[model samples]
Target chain A: MAIPDNQGGKRAADVIVTALEARITSGELENDKPLPPERDLMEEFGTSRTVVREAISSLANRGLIELRPRFRPIVRKPDYGTLLSATGTIVRYLLNEPGGVQNLYQSRVFIERGLVRDAALNATKENISDLKAALLANEKALDHSEEFFRTDIAFHGVLYRIGNNPIFPAMHEGFTSWLSPNWARMTRSDDHNRSVYLDHKAIYDAILERDPARAEEALIAHLSAAWSYVEETF
Target chain B: MAIPDNQGGKRAADVIVTALEARITSGELENDKPLPPERDLMEEFGTSRTVVREAISSLANRGLIELRPRFRPIVRKPDYGTLLSATGTIVRYLLNEPGGVQNLYQSRVFIERGLVRDAALNATKENISDLKAALLANEKALDHSEEFFRTDIAFHGVLYRIGNNPIFPAMHEGFTSWLSPNWARMTRSDDHNRSVYLDHKAIYDAILERDPARAEEALIAHLSAAWSYVEETF
Candidate 1:
């Protein structure tokens, strides 16, 4: 492979990163396989070992390769989980900024509003049944705060799953994980859990009735109440 | 500061990273100041130079600090730009995957739907004027496709800015940057630009009239039409 020369102020390492990234993303490098050994890359790119290592490190940072001690970096095909995981550190940092928590919470409310409306309009029979099962699980776990939180997320997961787009579920998971620090600080009780469960029930019932407006209203009410708990801790 | 022991199978570098990250995030380490010299960190952490360097690299990857070629790493207080920039690589990778573009587009639509509604319901007079300014600039740029695109994004940006939340504007910018590749590939003409400008005008008109439902409907219509153009290149 011909390595593009550094031009227009692009560094050698950047050129190598772009080239290798293209190959990896195009599946030419193949998943789970080791990238070219460091020496070979140096030889092919006509660069020093340092440049090759720099390129490899950059690629690893981009989630294109897995770097392990004493092992060659392995190619990783991009997946939804990897994509979302890449945002974790950034999200954590943002969560600490002023109004960060409220902004993120509002974003979630906006997103889930769309998801629930989509569920009401387009969910399959299996989707509704899955939501019902999740609601039941949530009801059963009401006395257990930790379990209640888990099932609460699972119930919301169904709304995401209804879209059959992997991005939605991954995004939902990201939101839950990122906002969880705040969630953890909130005082939980059976009464609080019961109120949340009732909100879910109302949302689910509206979805079952195919009433998008009502489903959206219930979702907003639920998230708004939940935000109040988080706000108290803040 | 006492360094935590590696009792939980955490690497030496990880422990150092965690310790330094806490210092930086907690503002113990001031932004724009160089972190302690390598020798100092090595002594303080009771680790080798390699471990200190490793920890520094990890911190840089998480965007907590900047590492120049010869200078000690400078502390960087987290900002919205840094947070969103970190998602750029992952978003690019996902845009290459099946249905990725469409999924991201749908997300933008969902987000903008909420934004336009918010603009309609809550926009102050100044917000309305800013949007009208953006709309007028967009009209003038219609004959220049590239300029028109910029003004188009600027118009949409007003919707994001209405909420006075940094996160929304950051998100809007992220979506534009991430999706611009697809938009670039679409055919553009004065006629096409005119249609998009009209859509923006409709959205602006609804916001000016304080009609949330109409604004939302216009937004959905506009975004749906825009998606068809992007979908064609698929």
Candidate 2:
């Protein structure tokens, strides 16, 4: 098939994708329903088998549909898995370029700043306790040395979970997963971990106090300090 | 070949992806070079033709490699295209859920807040003038409704460009593109457009004055006003 000839396949696929995406979003195609067979789609779009196939692939790429080998493709209720893969892919690419990782880090700061602010404004008391528990877990793990950092991450995860939208946690976790390698490379001095723990505590405290500005400030300070350590180490 | 089963294929593809990704990122395999043939990969990984082919598809899906039939797949020096697609994909999904679009909007705020802050701190005189010209374009286009909003968007685009890292602009543009459909639907009264222009001018003036705090505040105010309009209209 001459490997579908990139540009041509992409153009045809884009056409199919736009049509299908509109259908799916407008609820013309119900969620979790199977799409028509390739033969059917080929006839409907008045395109070749290769054109139809490429179009299906493009829709799959956009998380609008799922393509299975033997069965017809289906509309997808896609989730953070798609988000994580995309974020992870570009992040790895960015790590190789100048100021790339820093941009990623800056983006994380931006995301968490907003998340922390929202958590403070909207979190219930139950959510505050969860944050406290996550903080305690970090403190307990600090003695173990090996598991300390993960619980620290878990603390932020808990804070993110306080918001009504689940994507906040998912997005935060995605960046954390991508940044974990370099995270591990940083020198975690006993004092560093201890200080980090305190930073998380202060953030929790700010949220508990229902202080949005303070929560944001604490997060920015916490991230800035951690970033400084990374800079000094690397 | 029974469409390599999903989860099983995913596992196998992941293994291949990890190995090949390491090779590519490590520069053991240079960018733009064709990956080893499927037959070679099959033998190298001790996998079947179906398994190797599926693995290659996953790499291509992640934009790490591009699959070409009848020839070896090639390594991709992937760009913002992949990242933009992925961001757009997930953002579309997020827009349908509760608090989803809000989270996305908040994310944009965080990013631009940082971008504007940096621009004020770091922008060159030339960058400031470019922003001034964009603001003027927005002002001039006000009479012609269609081009007006685009020039308004271009103003932020210019601010994003002031930063050294190009990804800031790419990421902002990606979010803007995804959010634009909704942006277009809003009732842009003459008064609304005039106020928005003033907001942009304030942001520009902040940057020119080298006031990071004012820049961030102006941006937040501008976005907040826009958000309120969207909320009331919808």
Candidate 3:
């Protein structure tokens, strides 16, 4: 983790970033709340004006906080895009290491299991209806694997929406998109018809019944089998 | 979830970004791999050069890939800084909503328990030794809570390193820092001393014995109690 050096050969920016990051993360400074003015911060942290500006800029670039024109820096809410970018970075880093893919998938399964359970508990009527629509799309595309895959994802998207935690679905979707293309090619050789139908049906039944424990178990079983197939073949 | 617009007015850049993002996450492009030249990708996707360039720059800025001085853009490995940014964003967002603090603490417990479990299983002899050293540091801190807190983090950090996944520790570190400042107030109650020692000892014992199941159980119990306290107080 060799961090790049500062341009002006000063450590003030680095020190301020670290201190401010700790402050923000530790819940000392609440989200959507403003920090002290630049001048105030500079004086308080004993840093130059440039250091203060650079620290704020770095934070903004990372999407951690927003810097308004006149207002002080404030914490920002993360949307799906920020979540995915972060997921992409973590997954990519893990994938580059030796024997990282399997471990990455393992963590994905852990996260997805929890996500679906929450979705089972929290999903609204609208989300359930949308999930049903996506399932229908899946059934209609029985012969079209690509459409089936898209609809399958759309179904999960609904599941994610139902989960009600914005972070869970966004992160899950990012990893799924990363992992799915490989599985898609693998699925082509197998008898995808019966397994896909049954697995997805089990999930739908659990969701419709509002059985979170069952839903989570079914999801784990479904993905475990699917992932096992990928592991065996690919 | 309103995304920032693509620099160009049209939606083509957005489409290209989506497609390229999928490819990058799927490991189709791979870390440090060169992206196709602008002209080549444009012809393949039937999108304009501007669309492709915008997509690439967007991806780079988001930390998905990097734009080099010459030749094609390269897909770089994801790093801790990026994960921290994302985790911080998510935590901050959670903190903004009503009952958000409780929810954030719940998530913290969930993530940290899993991390400790994984860390226990993956820890090496050297990791254990390092962790022991941090524990000694903690003991020496006595009445100095700040030093104890810092060393306490080091103890867990060593465990994160043991998990054999770089991203886990990185993400954990990000969350730890994000949550640290508030921790002092949270941990300063009448019962803090006894509870912290016992819980820390339980985790330490499990790891020392290499009992993954025990380690996980202890971690969950510890976190569950802590979460209850935070929820009630914070």
Candidate 4:
């Protein structure tokens, strides 16, 4: 394969990535297959050892390949860590934009509704205990604003864990953590507090009762109110 | 802060990352703020220049900071590239597991249904036309598998763009591009051709008809059948 000139803001690493990714995605470079030696890749790509190392390192960081000492790098599938970090980054962008947080309520509503539905379907006795623990902690730490936020996160984290899907917990964690302190203060108003607390309680109760439809409805109601608050405030 | 000793199998870069991340996450260091000079940081962390540069580079690559020439590194808000790269990593992982293709169907159902719902509410005539063009390309490329898949991706891409949410398009692109082709071929059977084609037609009709509920239902039904096929195959 002819190596394209590293122009157009493309670097050696990008060249390697584009080539290797195509091969991997095309099924020509199957999983667990050892890649060409660094020297061989260097010659093929017509780059220095440093460039090849950077490319491989980048791939390894993404969990696309594993580099073992004294052996050729091996391709591995990516994982949840990659997704969590990526989602967190995206949510952070939304949080930073003007009026972005105000608009996020719709996306948040959809995710929470799905999460609550799964939680209702999958919540076991142990999961209930975990949820209760988080709720109790939240109640106890209400006076300590930061701790209150932490407990609040714990509550939602437990809910996602109980939902039986790996993707939701990370998304929840990333979104909540990225916007905690500001949202916590937003919830401090008397009207926001009463409405939010009640909505959370209703959703929690629906989960405890193992009613998927009710759980979804309660979560949606909660988010609708929350979105209204955001709209009015922002 | 006490500097943790780096042992065998851990590089100075890893140590620097752990310490810096702890400080950053704990709010000892503020977001969007610049770090101390490299010389000063190296002195404080008791690490080498190479180690400090590697640490900062890693952070920069992850969208945590931006390295400026002749100046301190500035903390950055999360950027889109990082988010896309991260999601690609997650899809890569999902492709590695047994019956991984089915999980993609689950994700598709969860994500695309919501995407099309919002798209129906938000899409412009220009966006709808772009989507139609993509669908036409998909139809024409039916005999060429690679071209068909590429156009299939473009079709979804147009839908995501129509949703007018930055998060969804980045995520949709990452998942589509990073997914394993072997896993995708599971749905390439002739039996699915008629069902998928008709579902796409219905979805297109709903979009053109500007019926949000019908659009969502059509997309969900399409994904649900895709999931069913995956389950049977696996």
Candidate 5:
């Protein structure tokens, strides 16, 4: 159970991290269970408290454990949100690079084009009703720019969710976070808000009609117009 | 520049991290420049060596700096590769979850569909020639499964690079890494390899003809067939 002392402290902590990660991932250490006390971990790994603490911090950063202020770290299962948690930092960094915002926005348009097509071809009654509700909320919030923006995002979010895949929603959330700064900088007037709402409405109508080509066309047009607005700000 | 002592060691480190990060990202610190000596940082931030080290480590993790065993940490301007460095760990975790592989594969298909269409619409003469070279290499490597597999990836990779966006190539790398395990487990045969080669040829031909719809059809057909092969092993 002893870790090699010849290696540096970071390597020693990494060894402990790998061992504990295997246990947590393989379910040998059950979720919600407090990992063995720090003293026991220190003794068992033949490492100092600092090494053990570093290992725990590393695990927590990887979303494999939950650390509390005065308690042993508890094993936790990672979900999509936890899996994508680091994306925010990376994306924030990317936003600073030239053309980074446009590239990201183009990627969003590409993904949403597929998503809206899927919604048209595969949306169920329940999905349509959800879209309707979102559309209504968007319409109601048209006069309130901040509310309108939230509901506007919500309406497009429904398209991402229509595929019933967890990855898409997480991706959509990432896009929203990454692109919001540009969207926020755009000059938002009643005319712009109304245009965006109508674009959403057109997308919804195409989905309701179950026309994949039309849905894709509407989505591209909407995103292209949105990009023009964002482009001006940039 | 004393950080509030009451906020604890972690918070004190974070305070130092924020100030250093601002200096680095604002280009004031400049890339490849050695950070101030640990003793100087300690005095400047009114913090201990451990706190300064922790801040340096955190910055390194976020791809903001490069750390060496005996040298001062140097600032790094993050690039696409560094920004996506964390994706491998998250993807490895996701592949362990039920349906994770298929979800990722479907997302790849969705992205590639858009990519192939873009390729058809916008590929320059040089891009087409690059793709042709990759295709020829793939054809030549057909007899060696390992080499063929690599060339096969390289051929598909050409499509990713055709768009001239750094993000697409990085994403293609991510999909390649995430999906390779499943692909590696699948049974490889001469017939299977030939079929995949033909699929690539058809996609290339469509792109050559400047037919977006035909290019997308070829891509979907190719990926669907590939998915079936993968599904059988699962």
Candidate 6:
């Protein structure tokens, strides 16, 4: 493959990235293979070690390659870390920039409605048991209160697991972490904890009963109640 | 701020990144302020120029800092590109791994349903006109064919504009591009074109009528039809 010479506004690393990107997407660099070593890449590209390293780092940052220090970089299946970071950053953007925290929370409602719908449609005996286990944990931990939050997050995560999609779990965790601190500040009352547990129990019962519409209804009610709390507190 | 010592597998760059991450997240490094110059950072961190640069790049990758060559790094608002890179990477992961393509399409359906519902509820005359302009352009450009796809994608993007949140558009564009090649193969027939146009028209009319439930119904129908075609073909 032909590698282009660096041009205006293009760093040497950028040029290497363009060349590597083409090779990777064109199937020349097989996913099973490691990239050429830094010394070889430096010699081949006639660039400094730092330039070659940066080029590889750029590819890694974009989730195109996996890098381990002192090892040849491996061609990688893009992973969830990229998704998690990106999602957390976007939530921060909505909170700090013009979109307001309400927009972020509303988006979460849309996503959870989809998740619970999928869980209800796809839930098996094992999935139901998993949901019950999480809820049972939540019920037992309420005395600890701090532990209430952990089980609550895990219950929603279990819903994603029933749907058998990695994407949902990644997104659920990201959205939950982003909203957690604000949610804690807004809903610290005893009444809030009781209702939160009851709302989750409703979601659990609906999923166990194999009713997607009911599950969505319970989730929407839960979100609506939470939204009211946030709006009122803020 | 106390900069932690580099230990175990942690490189000097990693040490600097940890220090910077703390200061940035704590708001000690104000968003309006650029980081200290490379020479200053190098002196402070007792690391090489390459290490300092890499640390800065790490912060930039996380959207904590913005890097411009020939300038000190500026603190930045986390932006859509980070989210886009993450999401596109995750989609790539699904395509390459046992995760399969179904997850990506299902995720898109979930997201679009939300976007269209928002568009219907929040749309104004300007938003409606934008949707109409895109639809009209699609109708007029059927012969160009490739332009047909562009307009189709643009039409959905316009829907996100009505919701007044930047996240949906970024996601729609990313997901559309990822699915474009597969969608092209599935819907190359003239029958596909006519139906696709009609489906979009249904969506536009629903939004113009300010009926969100109807808008969602049209979108779900459109997606189900498209999903069936993909499933049958691939």
Expressed as tens digits, the lDDT of each residue in B58-129 for candidate 2 is: 577667786654557789766655576545655676687766667778767867886787788788889988
Report the C-alpha lDDT of model 5 over A1-234, residue by residue, as the tens digit.
111112343467778988998888889999899999889999999999877876776676566787655666789876666655655566777788788898888889888988888888899999999999999999999899989999999998998898888999988887886788788878779999999999999999999999988999999999999989888875
Error at A75, model 6, angstroms: 8.5
Where does candidate 5 stray beyond 4 Å? A1-10, A27-40, A65-76, B1-10, B27-40, B66-75
Which structure is stronger by TM-score: 1 or 3?
A: 1
lDDT of 4 by residue, B15-62 (tens): 786677656655577877998777888998898776786677666545
In terms of lDDT, which candidate is strongest? 1
Every candidate's lDDT: 0.83, 0.75, 0.66, 0.66, 0.82, 0.74
Per candidate, native contacts kept equal: 0.39, 0.29, 0.13, 0.24, 0.26, 0.33
> At residue A35, what lDDT does model 5 achieve?
96
Clashes of each: 0, 1, 3, 1, 0, 0
Residues A30-100 of candidate 2: C-alpha lDDT, one tens digit per residue: 88899877788888888877667666665675566776655668887656555664456666776767666
Runs of candidate 2 exceeding 4 Å displacement: A1-76, A114-127, A186-190, A206-221, A228-234, B1-59, B65-75, B97-100, B117-127, B187-190, B206-217, B228-234
Better of 2 and 4 by TM-score: 2
Comparing only chain B with the true structure, the TM-scores of all models are: 0.90, 0.77, 0.61, 0.64, 0.87, 0.74
Tens digits of per-residue lDDT for model 3 on A1-234?
A: 322212343446657877777777667768789876889988998877766866776566556676544556787545545555434545555565565666667667666665666567677788778878877877787677777777766766776566455555665667676677557667542267557766777888888898977887898788888787777754
For every prediction, compared with the true complex, DockQ reads 0.33, 0.27, 0.12, 0.17, 0.32, 0.29
Off by over 4 Å in 6: A1-48, A63-77, A86-94, A98-100, A118-126, A184-190, A206-214, A228-234, B1-47, B59-77, B86-94, B98-100, B117-130, B184-190, B206-217, B227-234
The TM-scores of all predictions, comma-separated, are 0.86, 0.71, 0.57, 0.60, 0.88, 0.74
lDDT of 1 by residue, A1-234 (tens): 111112354657777989998898888999999999999999999998877876776676667787776677899876767655555666776788778899889888988987888788888999999999999999999899889989999999888888777878877877887787798978788889899999999999999999988999999999999998898986
lDDT of 4 by residue, A1-234 (tens): 011112365565668977887676566878889887889989999998767766776675555676554567898545554455435434554566765674454556666666777678787899988877877776676666557656766777887676455666656755665554346446554444445556667878898999977998898787777556556554
- Candidate order, DockQ descending: 1, 5, 6, 2, 4, 3
Q: Give one digit per residue, the lDDT tens place, for model 3 in B130-220.
A: 7777767766764676666676677667766665656567656665766554565675542565466567778888888878668768887
CA-based DockQ, model 1: 0.33
Compared with the true structure, model 5 gives a TM-score of 0.88
Worst 10 residues of 6 chain B by lDDT: B1-10
TM-score pick, better of 1 and 2: 1
